[model samples]
Target: MEHSHKAILVVSFGTSYEDARKATIERIENDIIAAFPEYRIYRAWTSRMILSILKKRDQIIIPNVCEAMEQMIDDGITEVIVQPTHILDGIENHIMKDEVLSYKSCFQSISFGAPLLSGQKDAETIVHAIGKRFEYLDKNTALVLMGHGTAHQANAVYEELGQLFKDMGYPHIFLGTVESSPSVQELIQEISNYGISSRNCDSADNDLPVEKVVLAPFMIVAGDHAHNDMAGEHPESWTSRFQNAGYEAESVLKGLGAYQKIRELFVEHVQNAINNINE
Candidate 1:
């Protein structure tokens, strides 16, 4: 399993947010290129809908694992390694893995990389990344992370993130899903239970209205969910939901991949996967 023959495939769930998604993918690709300069590099997007929706005449269309590997084979590439830029081993990563495994015969060897927040080390890195972006608010305010939860087992990772935030001694960190358990409504109820009013009220000391509460997504890119579901003006969105609940809600559009520390997790995962192949 020599590294020289292998072509590194960086795969992501893809995003409709053209500029935002491109920046995230480019950073990961640049990091891999920097580390494994000897290995040929290819980029892929796992979401077909996203790719189709964000397609541009000028930008290179992100290929899938099979398509990228086929291209590598055409270029005389023998060995191949795939690194999924997904945040977890969810549906997107599972699909990529299946596609890569189907082409095992095409290459001398094939290796798959781990998701961004795979293990404890990766989790710590994520926590560090988030910490860098937000400071722990006082007991009066809490940080809420909205993740695109799935029915898949990987969705439990959202709970892990919540626990991590709790262990970090942050003031009552809360987690919610866009599609799974611990739904946004549940999270809102829990937050309201804390007596943290979502409304702007005049400060007793300053005599001025003070807004409290910050909401951020636990996603890799602030794509559809972040833009529409979390921050959209729609009445059913999390932002509107929070507002209706009497809380001032603010949405942080930056996804997990936007953080340098989180990006480093991708690099570490790629390196570890490459090392495993060597072993």
Candidate 2:
């Protein structure tokens, strides 16, 4: 039997960190490519606005999913499967899904792969991924993760990640959102209070210096937020805020997606979605 699948579309939210974004997308694409060598892999970016801004600055070329689909057809592809590389069911994934639906009439079959972080299994995989990247400092330092929170119900997924860290036995893990609950200031206050609480609770026999902390973004790429908000030395940035609060702070520029385990999670997501296509 001849398998006539056209291509696997890997849709991402598009990152300014061009190399980093390509690496992450390629990791997932390679997995699908290896599994279905007969099917071609097409890449699509969901953030047209971001890509447009990058294009104006000569940063990146804006990718169009429709055009890519049309190209696949022109190349003699008859069946198409879109695998979104988004982390959540947010605007990016929604936009990609809508775009894929628009081409349903053109293909014999059109299916979607799953998002990176979706259900409990996905959350656990992400936690495992993050865990493998960092060893506990033993400095009683709080690890704060800044996520791109949204107004959608999926924003609650951030809390799930917080709980995952808690369940992993991390003593002090805090979740902050760039756009929603537990705002940056709120996170700073929480960290300050935690430091104060820790300092005041030390017993005479257990003398320990004020614990230093590390701030890292929970995003998929070390893009603008990671660079400007978390790691930047600006007076208003998280690193500066932590220093002003009398606690040492450092930032890890790598996002979760850059980690190998995290990359594997996306592969699992794609595999599961492809397996479930018949169901």
Candidate 3:
């Protein structure tokens, strides 16, 4: 293989689900490879648990960010760009950036790209992508996007994206987090308040009641959270609640990384980070 001093490190909170890891994380890395073929691409995962599991179970050894940086230094690479697949600028993003920045003096030019949903425009793009995906739904159905929320202020991205759905002409859509506000309970209430509930034809316009609700992961990779928490048979799963509420509930079982537009945003962010070398 040819050697390159410049490298792109595609970072992600790795998943143990092989299929999901391929569908989401691998796809994103492939997108990066295609966009920047001139630069060699390396991967680093933020998930220590996943790393351990893969190493123990499959004999696969993937380095963490710190290790990856050390490897790059040993390889005599002086230019680096770290791109995270995290959905928000939350704790994960912060930790990754700090680790990458810790090696600032080792590389002549090192930059960290923005997360998947970094600002207003990113939220709008996500709304449009998801809106297009669920355009088939009518007023009798609601599309609930489930995000992996954090206590960090960046968790606001979930609610912000939810409102953007309305502003972008998809009022039937909603966003909820597994760990924060707009929680499952809040979504039930939001559904009820919006008159989209199938129970209690209390809405003045009974015909407008939602007959179905689709749950999809708004995170990059739909692994454990998507499988067990969002669609699992457990009684508290999102699917179970909607099913019990007299609505036909379905889990999309796919992640944001499955979308082309979403991948494009990450590519754009990487380019922006590469450009930072000049500044």
Give the range where candidate 2 is weakest over 10 consecutive residues by summed lDDT.
Answer: 202-211
Prediction 1 global C-alpha lDDT: 0.77
- Please give the CA lDDT of all the candidate structures: 0.77, 0.74, 0.89
Clashes of 1: 4
Top-down lDDT ranking: 3, 1, 2
For model 2, how does the per-residue alpha-carbon lDDT over 1-279 read when each residue is reduced to its tens digit? 675556677777777676766656666667678877767788777667777878888756756787787777777776677777677888778877887788788777777777877788878777766665566566466777888888888888887688778788654777888788768788777667756666787575432334676888887777888889777888988888778877788887777666777767776666666666656
**TM-score, candidate number 1:** 0.88
Task: State the weakest 10-residue window (summed lDDT) of model 3.
Answer: 196-205
lDDT of 1 by residue, 81-167 (tens): 788877788887787788888878878888888988788878877776676567645545566788888889998888778778768
The candidate with the higher lDDT, 1 or 3, is 3
Clash pairs (backbone) in predicted model 2? 6-79
**Which number leads on lDDT?**
3
Query: What's model 1's lDDT at 18?
Result: 69
Instruction: Please provide TM-scores, in order, for all candidate models, with all chains considered together.
Output: 0.88, 0.87, 0.94
Better of 1 and 2 by TM-score: 1
Residue-by-residue lDDT tens digits, candidate 3, 173-246 = 99999999889889887887777344556656444666789999988899999998899999999889878877
Q: Candidate 3: which stretches are off by over 4 Å?
A: 196-207
After TM-score superposition, the amount by which residue 114's alpha carbon in candidate 3 deviates from its true location, in angstroms, is 0.4
